[model samples]
Target chain A: MPQGQPEVVPDDGLTTRQRRNRPLLAVHTGSMKGKSTAAFGMALRAWNQGWSIGVFQFVKSAKWRVGEEAAFRALGESGAGGPVEWHKMGEGWSWSRKRGTEEDHAANAREGWAEIARRLAAERHDFYVLDEFTYPLHWGWLDVSEVVRTLRERPGRQHVVITGRYAPEELLDAADLVAELTKVKHPMDAGQKGQRGIEW
Target chain B: MPQGQPEVVPDDGLTTRQRRNRPLLAVHTGSMKGKSTAAFGMALRAWNQGWSIGVFQFVKSAKWRVGEEAAFRALGESGAGGPVEWHKMGEGWSWSRKRGTEEDHAANAREGWAEIARRLAAERHDFYVLDEFTYPLHWGWLDVSEVVRTLRERPGRQHVVITGRYAPEELLDAADLVAELTKVKHPMDAGQKGQRGIEW
Candidate 1:
């Protein structure tokens, strides 16, 4: 009332401070050997704890691949409280020789990552996982420092898990815990073909 | 007279020869910074050369944010020609607040990655970018050595790109090109908020 524009009254009555209670958990794996399975189990456990969760696939192009989407569907169908929203990379893979232009690819990647960041901010998930995030960093499609900064800046007590082969030392330093996977043998080495359900 | 189980027929009409094409140009950006954007641009450039491309987001959980998915979609729509398929991580981020009987997270991660590997094997792409592949290695979800061997053993002249923050030095040594995105300045420091379609 004193000023030309009435001072905007802070809606303290309507505003309820959101309690940041979740922990940021980074799960960095060495290889793809058993990552999917392990990730799934951990997600289920968290879901059982009544934690709202968000799932994301960092670098995947195929619609039919039964990795992230399948797991969510199965869990939701198996009585998980809510369905896990799935997001897939539209560009199947960026290594095609027929690509049109660099700007096009950069724009695409930027859009894809922007979408992911938006969801992370909007949703009130207790846990957020950045899957195969290393690819973007490795390919130079995403800025690693920016990503790390985003992770560090994400508000709330949300636990973030990053799965991939190599986690930057900086990320590891920032992480509360770090685990490494080493492979001694695999069926492929014995000339056996990958099996569905078991392998896939 | 035919021998038991049909005499092993050695193909005389067809000559078994390998094509000596340029080795698949694979780039891995371990440091974060702008690696994702760089990878996307590089991939798009490679695509313009009329080479079939495959992009794999090794970690499936990190891309859940809306910003991340939108980036990929934009890329696909930007006349890159052909669809960019994304393999999503259905399970939310993997973290064990409480331990259980089974190795759930590991199992889920493995399944998703196996699916990706299967697709890579079946599809014929000129370039394959494995995004955020390092998490699997750090988490003990996948086999590092085995993955390296498989990548080395892949057929065709397909180029591979692996991006992550902490790529093993061994991988860097083996790679044809290795880049690290170092962090210098970030918007977070300036108090600039993450804008939609800008920072994902």
Candidate 2:
């Protein structure tokens, strides 16, 4: 559990309820697994609460069959809870002329950030999960300062969760909740590969 | 983002299929939230894969309403997939007469370990989630070496995930996957309380 609290409270003197309702900006980083998985779990909770959810994935190929994506999509289509929009920014690699080039990835990243920024301004989703988003910021493909400013100024009750290793300092400083997943140990150190269902 | 691979592969030369069929022992620990939450998220995935699930909460109160518990229980009871067994070790606080002191928690912890051991021996569930289990080992209430040995020698394809802040060295060494969640930032320091849906 996080033992440290923000040292100072806002001058507004918000009540517990108000603080609870306020959207949180969270960052899940560090070199370990479950960063995206944990954020997805929060999305599940948000969906259960009838909050609209949006998941934007980067780095990971769109073809990656993450079980959570299928499960959450089914739940959304079932009409049993809030709607969910899952966008995979790494869907296609066939850029032809610019195939496998850094510029291609950079352009796509910038485009993805632009979309997220627009949605944040519009408050399109109650909960926004920017899965592996820190990579773009770290690679300098997307402007970290711009992202910090946009996320800080996002409207409504939009809770944003960004996950990726080597998160920049600017994002961490602006985030209300940040959890860094450290690798205490892994089977791969013993020669095991990532397994299905578990790794996915 | 772990760069290290297991130093050597076993002489057994197991194929991908054989390896994929094997169970995993994962530990989620450290002074940050989402240890159990990530484990539960894995449970959600396991449920989707038609794997039976067992969740044992060692420290949290039974009366506590965790969103994952309710969600998983509902999924279990729905009969759409595998069943789930939810056990709360700290259900009642009134055992002070014969127990309830530090010793009481230790006794319960031992008993809980025994039950889990029995079930693991019996292969009761494909996925077992030992939530907040590290505290007992850290507290000397449960023997770390014993737990490590038990996990190492457990039979069948039953996967286990243990979560707590101060995980024991023995358990970490035995675990195939271990994640340590570090607290980078928190709202509590600002006097903000944990919120519904997000926290629970």
Candidate 3:
């Protein structure tokens, strides 16, 4: 070896080091069918793979809605055990109903969105699900461009999943995968009634 | 009985139905989260209660994303067996993605939304969940006010669930329930690995 030669590093350490790759996933469902259920299945698959997950449901408040916490706990209790943390939009639908001043509602929505964005940026969850994110854009409560930009700028190797009927084109374009559910024939067409464990 | 009294019918040949007191549920999860699983659970609960149901999804093209048919089958296979049908948005998301072509995207989105509105107005289903409804809004692909008005004008005892992050205040105001999930902790924070069954 030359006197001035630098010591060569062993390849073992380099090979053993883990590579991080975070993929953004957007699941767009067309209609009332089963988009949510499908998204859940995919998440379950991911969770089963030993990945820690972060769950977010937009446009949701704990007052009138059945909380995802119950559902998450139920999922865990049903033998789909794993450590899953949940983050929820807390203001509920007060803005949509015009229950409060526009300023108040706007403030709440902004606060909620900021929290979501912060979490998305700060955490390194293996998976992040933004549930019902499209409504803000649909109702003119949030800027779509900002959302797209934020999603594009998300840090870490976390995988993102979005589910809803009308996904914006920008989001779909940026998405690696998109799934749409269509309506063909339905029971209501034939006057059949919706039953429990089937239509809830 | 008085001679002028009308006969009291026990059941006007219509099946006794229970009103669905539950709020409509919509979920948006990016990419590969368990949205479908959650939808399936909700559907199953509603189905067991004897309510008519309808399902639809928006697809840009037949070849693009996973079709609603597969999702329905998967949900059903996962024990959500019920009378659920899937519909496609027909127009894909690509047309909306093209910049400077707002008219085309709007037209397609309107057409798709018209179909949804028609179904909602028909009041055939007690619960309606628009999976990716926010995409069109985010892309400037659809008119948010129009969609909200249509939903607000929907008749009967129908409960609607619109899931997606970034829902506007107008839509949120129109909703009876709103939920937002915030992320607190995650496994990826410490560099844990993601596997197939857990993070798919």
Candidate 4:
């Protein structure tokens, strides 16, 4: 809660402790960087608290493994903290099928949404990261209204974080927390290129 | 690069390969959450890459140790990756002095900035997190122009990430990458209390 936090009363009729324990729907969207990075940061926080983590990447290739994915996957497999289940479009969402066109990508996005909707209904994980999920709604591959409804009605104390640029209005309306990252400047503007450790 | 990456040519005439190796001055600011969290997330990335990390917090009291500090400190002390030196205003910046009233806090912030300026001049760490550094500048406790000049002319390829709301224009102008986080919705607005794992 930084600035202009709306005055909210106890509308849910829950005790403070109970309300603190409730699940959260968080959206990270905008033109600047770190939307997915912030979502993954929350996942790291949640995982450290022994919460089961589920990560679903919508756009990145299966071969494109970011460092967070590697660290979380390794930490999850360490048999010390909560286990993590990671899925990507080419891998779990599309059943390892090759996709080269917009149509196939749209279909996979839909498939991914369907699976996530089912998991939300089932309350499979304590924390769910829908990394770069806004693109499908922005692209009209998934119905924004339906996505909002499903997330708003998601079951149990499962926290879900969706990240991408151009997040739909309906989704924002339904989210419990929303961060719109605006760009004030960028390294590329200065002709400085991105490196693997810092950029990825 | 996400949406609307500025079309920038290499005005410095450096090769893309050469530009890729240069470190950056990143700023996360505005009236929203995830500013510091995003900076900490980058620290995680840097830790994984074996880059020595230094985190300096200005506004938050030293008693308030966030989860990232714990994790990074643990990783740093484990004799793995690179070292982490975390300093808050109350700890390293206050010169072991008792703090009371806003004047003392302001003085501590100024002292903290002086130490960090020296560190930046010395190129002590590969990656630096100036958490909540903008508040002092916004409050006129620190000179924004001096901060910008020092950061712009800091020695070595050490990447610096500064986080806070209402970052001064001069700092943003000097930054290599800037993210302005905008508030859309917040749990505090819904009267949902913050818990340790999620909020910290």
Model number with the top lDDT: 4
Q: Which regions of candidate 2 deviate over 4 angstroms?
A: A1-12, A63-65, A77-81, A92-104, B1-21, B63-65, B77-81, B90-108
Candidate 3 global lDDT: 0.52
Best by TM-score: 4
* TM-score of candidate 4 on Cα atoms, chains taken together: 0.85
iRMS of candidate 1, Å: 19.5
Model 4, range A53-171, lDDT digits (tens) per residue? 99999865664436666667666765555688888885545334444444477878888888889888998899999988898899898988888888888778999899988888888
What value does the lDDT take at residue B200 in candidate 1? 34
Docking class of 3: incorrect
User: How would you encode candidate 1's per-residue C-alpha lDDT over B1-200 as one tens digit per residue?
Assistant: 00112123333343222211334434435333344444543444344343455555555445322333333343344443334444434333223223233346566556656655665577566666566666666676788777676676666566676766666655665564454443333333322233222223
Docking class of 2: acceptable
Supply DockQ values for each candidate: 0.02, 0.39, 0.08, 0.43
Could you tell me every candidate's TM-score relative to the true structure? 0.42, 0.83, 0.45, 0.85
Local accuracy of candidate 2 as per-residue lDDT tens digits, A1-200: 21224456666678757976888999998887788878877776777777888888886576443567766766576555678888766663232233444447778788778888888988888989888888889999888888899998888888999998889998889999988888877776666766655766
Per-residue lDDT of candidate 4, residues B1-200 (tens digit): 31223367666777777788887889998877788888877777787777889988885555443556655655676554668888887554544455443447777887888888888888889999998888899999898888888888888889999998888888887878888788877888777766766876
- Which digits, one per residue and each the tens of the lDDT, describe model 1 over residues A20-79? 122445555565243433344345445444456666666444432253344344344444
Which 10 residues in a row give candidate 1 chain B its minimum summed lDDT? B1-10
- Relative to the unseen true structure, what is the C-alpha lDDT of residue A101 in candidate 2, on a scale of 0 to 100? 49
Using DockQ as the measure, which candidate wins?
4
